[model samples]
Target chain A: MIEFHLNSRSGLSPYQQLVQQVRHALRLGLLREGDRLPTVKDVARQMAVNPNTVLKAYRELEHDGLVAARPGVGTFVTRTLADDTLAAQGPLRKDLRRWLAKARLAGLDDESIEALFVSTFRSTAGEDVA
Target chain B: MSAVLRARGLGKRYKKRWALQNCDLEVPAGRVVGLVGPNGAGKSTLLKLACGMLTPTAGTIEVCGGRPAAGVEQLAKVGFVAQDTPVYAALSVADHLDFGKRLSPGWDDAEARDRIRRLGLDPKQRAGKLSGGQRAQLALTLGIAKRPELLILDEPVAALDPLARREFMQDLMEAVAEHELSIVLSSHLVSDVERTCDYVIVVVDSQVQVAGDIDDLVAGHYRLTGPRRDMDALPAGQHVITASHTDRQTTLVVRTDTAVHDPSWTVDPLGLEDIVLAYMARPADAVRDTRPALEVVR
Candidate 1:
């Protein structure tokens, strides 16, 4: 079972945070196909959050085809997101480490490096979509 | 969606003072609604009016499709936990349970006992000996075991420490999940409301400043900063809630239904706390001319 924790400082809505955490776990291979997600009541009780928030997050996941809720049973993961991208992570990690070292050696601070990476990442992704 | 609590021009008076006045509210069923405001904002008076502890002096108020406390059946439809989570100091925990069982027609003894067991409270202990958190939980148990369709709580956790408050909220949410109960809880803690409530009602200076779904309220409000300009020069769709200006720059919090397409101003979304604070900071009589009275938009 995957236990969820909330970061109040994250500035994301509770339901959005739940959705993101599930996606993060799926991509990290911590959750795989057929895994049962915690029931809405359990999550609400454990996290001290409204059950409707949990229900909304589950509905969004179901819409994305990542999970399915079976009547009178718990929700189950229907897809694994760790297939294609998992294979390329090693090379990507090496490249990212090398670039980070180069940036630090060039006198960029941690915040500057993060800002640079995030802006470049967003613009590149936006261009691809456009 | 049927309204669990509906009020139109509801007002209450005490001697020469109006505790709450000109209030209009329509709360939909199955929502955990947060009623937040400063002290003396009349949150308690409004809650008392809803549960029929106090009668309206001006207009009508309906709860669960009937007048509040109109009859035994009407009283059975709504449960209330008054301020400070009041419990009988002399009674034992079990005695309190018995009292609840004898009074409420829809009492659920098994559920109440199971909850008490999970909470680890001994039934033999007197209520006065319990900690503040424990006492609050005991009161909440009474409210829930009655199986009311709508539960109204007035500052239920204000006296407890943070940890106790968290556990109390956890139990409350679990009960809502199990019973599909609607809630209207008043509090001064915005962060708690943001975390546990789907709907929000901001009562400031004895009036409802704003009420809506939390997500909708957050999405529809924004903070804009740009060159100094007159408030009247703003676009028609952007209704300013609060504005502050320096000689060179103007900052405003606005509620707009449409997107802010103006390139000159830097617009950023606001968190629920910021939005509520902005409304609270506004002068009671200010901004009435700029926008119509804010209402719950379905």
Candidate 2:
């Protein structure tokens, strides 16, 4: 499932949030192609949004070929994007840069930043992955 | 799609008073439905029952198509933000987020953090010190971050100023559009409901007055205001839901989707609030043998 949230104080729309999160998750390899998302109702309920809103987002996703809907079954991620592209332009590189920016702003030494990033990355990725 | 919430003859009682009665409703998937009524109309009771926070005394209640009670696995699918957007006064905005992360198994911490950043809320600032609007925003954030299947908000922005209310509603609508979440929000303000919901359920005196698509209700229902005309003269297939009189003029609200090719009095379009108040003011004995003076839609 693509876990979602909405900020009543943010400039972004709820549909945008849903779209971004689902795509971000796909790019991060957190949600693989063929991963079935919660039903539109399910997403709506969880996110405090209208089902129409979620439907619009899903429709957009389907249009983008990022998700495939099976009649009477459910919506799932489709293996349309190449792994190489998924490995490159998604969240991984962006997340790394984000961590780097934070570390640099905190005035951390290069070695300290590297150690922190490696530890945090390992923890997030799982002990076995490390 | 499965019904996210179901109520059959579900009712609530408060001492000698009946808050809601003979209520039967099925909330289908993928809609932002609004619950509206006057104070003490049992709107809160209905929401509480749907959230499984209150047990019904008279009939069945279900959330996510199962019993709406404590420990029902389906409870995990419903996210409820109660009235007043309560939060710990002493906790920081960040602390509240941490609490949500710990308590809600489906909590999306990253999303919550990102939202906080996007909203420009000082996560480290004490929640008690935040303004009412900020508090409501935080409550909304927590509710949305849980990722439940149904989110029920009880007067979520009732405390804010007009600007704040508009912002809150806009934000909510945006989120609804983004997440496609089905929301059941309760409010006494029909204006808010009118702007935010496509579907509406009017709870009056602890009873469901009417529930349906706003467009259907509007297009199906008409306001006839004109010279006093006998109801019997009105065309067949029209059912009057409410009627009023002022000397020579009789105003009636009737539902006729087939179209009134010709009518006795001029028909008028009813705004959402007008229709709601019409039903809210419906007299117990309003349904009478005499046809209300019918006015033709011009």
Candidate 3:
């Protein structure tokens, strides 16, 4: 079972956070197809969040075709996101590590490195959309 | 959708002073609703009115599809845990459970005993000796085991420490999930409300300022910062809730159902706390012309 935790400082709503965490886990291969999610009551009791928030998150995931709920049973993952990108992660991690080392050598601090990476990623992604 | 609580021009007066006035609200069933405002902002008055503990001087209120506390049946449909989580000081935990079983026709004896055990509360310990958190839990147990359709709590965790507070909220949420219970809890702590409630009611200066689903409220409200300009020149759809201006910039929190397309202004989405605070910060006597028609209908 995948345990859900909320980051209050993240600015995302609780439901959004839950949806994102499930996607992140799916992409990371930590959660595979057929894995049952923790019950709404379990999540609400453990996380101290409104059960409605958990229900909304699960519904959104089901709407997105990532999970499905069986009446009287529990919600289960129906899709795995790790197929396409997981294979490329190793090379991407190596490249990112190299880039980080080079940036440090050039005297860029962590914050500057993050800002540069984010700006470059955004502009490139925007161009691809256009 | 049926409303668990409805009020129309509801007002309460204490002889010479009006504690709450011109309040109108409709809270839908099966949702966790939070009532929030500053101290003495009539949050308690509104909750009390819904439970029929206080008679309205001006208008009517309906709870659980009937006048609150109208009869034994109506009373059975509503459970109230007042401020500071009042419990009978002279009664033991076991005594309280027995009292609940004897008094409430729908009392869930197994559930009551299970909760007391899970809370690690000694059945024989007198409520007068329980810690604040424990007392709150015991009171909540009674409230929940009574099997009311709606549970109304007034600042239930105001006296709890941070850890105890978290525990109490967890239990409450669990109860909601298991029993399909509707809850109306009041708290001045916006963060608690943000995490624990799907619907929110903001009371300020003895009036109902705004009420809506939390998501809609957050989505409809925006913070815009731009060059100083006349507030009256804004688009008709944008209703200013609060505004501040410096020599060069005007910052405003506004409510609008449409997108803010003004290229010159930077629009930022607000968190639940920020939205509530913006409403609370609004001047009590601010021009009603700028205020959006109260959207409590939903």
TM-score for each predicted model, relative to the true structure = 0.92, 0.67, 0.92
**Which of the CAPRI classes, incorrect, acceptable, medium or high, describes model 2?**
incorrect
Residue B292 of model 1 has an lDDT of 65
B1-298 in candidate 3: lDDT tens per residue? 9999889989999888888988778889999999999999999999998898999999889998999889999988999999999988999999999999988989999999999999999999999999999999999999999999999999999999999999999999999999979999999998899899999999988888889899888878899999999899899888899999999999999988877777688777899999999989998876356434565237
* Model 2 residue B64 distance off true place after TM-score fit, in angstroms: 1.2
Worst 10 residues of 3 chain B by lDDT: B288-297
Which pairs clash inside model 1? none
Residue-level lDDT of model 2, residues B248-281, one tens digit each, is 9998887775555454566555667777888788
Whole-structure CA lDDT of model 2? 0.76
Give candidate 3 misplaced runs (Cα > 4 Å). A87-130, B290-292
Which ten-residue region of model 1 chain B has the weakest summed lDDT? B287-296
- Candidate 1 lDDT, tens digit per residue, B1-298? 8999899989988998988887878889999999999999999999999999999999999999999999999988999999999899999999999999999999999999998999999999999999999999999999999999999999999999999999999999999999979999999999899889999988888888888899889888999999999988878878889999999999999998777767678777799999999999998887355336364255
Query: Model 1 reaches what TM-score against the true structure?
Result: 0.92
lDDT of each: 0.91, 0.76, 0.91
Error of 1 at B197 (Å): 0.6
Cα lDDT tens digits for candidate 1, A1-130: 7999888888788888999999999999999999999999999999999998999999999999999999899999999889878899999999999999999999999999998987577456545755
TM-score of chain B of each: 0.98, 0.91, 0.97
Give the CAPRI class of candidate 1: medium
Give the clash count for model 1.
Answer: 0
